[model samples]
Target: MTVPFYMCCQYVDGKFCFVLHEWCAKLPLKVQHHVVHPAHTFFLLPKIPSKFFGVFNCNICKLPSNGFAYGCTMCGIYVDINCAFIPKEITHDAHPNHLLSKVKPLVKLTKRNCKACNYPMRFRWGYDCTSCDFYIHLDCALFLPRVTKHKCDEHTLSLRYEPAENHISEYFCEVCEDEFSPWKWFYHCTRCAQSMHTTCVPLILQCEKSRMTYDSGGVYNFLNVKFGGTLEIKGHSHHLTFVQGLESDGRCIKRRYVLELSMIFKCLEFALMDQIDHFDHHHPPSLVHLQQPSNKSEEDDDEDEEKDEDADNFVEEEHHGGKCNMCNEQIWSFHLSYYHCESCL
Candidate 1:
């Protein structure tokens, strides 16, 4: 798929000129009360601290960072610079009565969850109201885009926290027809009264016109080009230079977001994978996911609630080769990525 032309970078003379993404350039040099260690101030660091073990983990996004970050060494909290922009307080539609404050992980034992969605606060990342006792995962928070338009509705759909009180029994998603929870956030057209899930809001079908289908046959990872560096891919003949998403660069957002959203449904993917080390592999094997083709289109492309099941079924279908001693999965590694022993992989 084509990179949003805006990401091509303005005021740049060359493709590898070490320019920052437009969104990256706008981040404040210093931030406070908005990251992992909210009380401490986070400074934009050019390099990760040496005190961190072999790999530096961002407590905010729960992702590893080899590039730029906002860090608070005092409390040992480093965050992916992109996620640091998340506001400490946000007004979400799911609860219109109170502005939900951001919830983060604490050092000691803490118990919390999203009252809606039934997902627990594993990363301890969410937006919540203490007195009202409301909580929602950061994954849900990311879906709350203020406004969007789709072909299903004749007019623009405005995001609403709750459905109309005067609604009929048919207050369900126009796209999926699943009955929506009254307190759950959704998109609605005032003129048509049609409602849709916030996660189902990608009407810009640019891929159809371009004749591109996002599958599991692409190099997928969190591309960190915020500082403009080069990385040599394993077994590749040459060193690969980092570019922040380019149209011709061959990296797809469908791969990036699908893998990212897996954390929403299955928090166990990385939480258990990262801490363990195999005898053959020094680094944790990265998890990658490509969006499946839905009836219409994408942001993470397709698979959402069904991702966990689809992935399990894919692994079960692999019987072409001998199994790895580590996990007993088929020894196949071409385009698809799986968490397995590097030597066997």
Candidate 2:
């Protein structure tokens, strides 16, 4: 048998206290016989502070904020409800030219790699090209702009690359803020004691192309950049040899680090399903898939044989084995990147 709950109330001075119902009469405390049953046992809790219920958004991830919140509401400041707060400005010696910027949602629908992570920048909120697709997380892109002159003797370093070399770095690039000795086709500034990875140079280019610039030395700098092969890599000196046809491992490292090749193939499948979207706007609508060979391949050894088999299997499955999920047309592996049909995407 369970006991019913009741609440009790007390009255003072002169008149007898009143019980609203029989349940109140049976409460725990019977002060001056005023106690009611389960009703009297109820406890009253103190009111809580309203400030404890404020909100914020995650500074790193940009999720909804919670907990003891304090921010500029007028500027839409917020953070995740349960995350710890971080400082806005970071100080470093390597990047003395400018302070780092904190941001998120660097790019959208990009099938490329991130210069910092050496992986695909997909579905992540991190530091990014304010104007273009280049992106980096706060923790990753953190660097102190160089202040003093570099220790190297060959070049008189400047914060900016010289125009004579076509905007290319004059010395070695320091990856992960490592010590620089000798490297080619890399950017360096002896005067500023600064160096950057060759891959990082592309980031500057993309920023320039997008016409995006941030405050550099109290001036609102623009992305006015040009590129020429002037610097040389220490280990891989041949990097500067084949200008246009350089087989860069950076691309491979990027895909391998982030999304697997299977995902790329999956994206290809999605592309085939929606080939029309990838088509040139000027060209007449022809049900053809434009094939752009992938830059890197994981299964290089079996790629040739597996591709043929996959093509056959795709044809059999799409044409008769299974329905095209996009437009209900029959498709096969041969029709992987480009699917032909009215009903397909």
Tens-digit lDDT track of model 2 for 253-342: 333332211111111112222334322133233344434466766676456666666554554443325554434665544554443444
> How many backbone clashes can be found in candidate 1?
1
**What TM-score would each prediction reach against the true structure?**
0.42, 0.21
The local distance difference test score of each candidate is: 0.53, 0.34
lDDT of 1 by residue, 136-252 (tens): 766456634667788877788886655565564666667645565545566788888788655444423322111111111011122232323445545645544432232222323
Could you tell me the lDDT of residue 183 within candidate 2?
Answer: 19
Model 1 worst lDDT run, 10 consecutive residues: 210-219
Which regions in candidate 2 have their CA more than 4 angstroms from the true location? 1-119, 123-125, 129-131, 146-164, 167-187, 190-345
Clash number for each model: 1, 60
In lDDT terms, which candidate is top?
A: 1
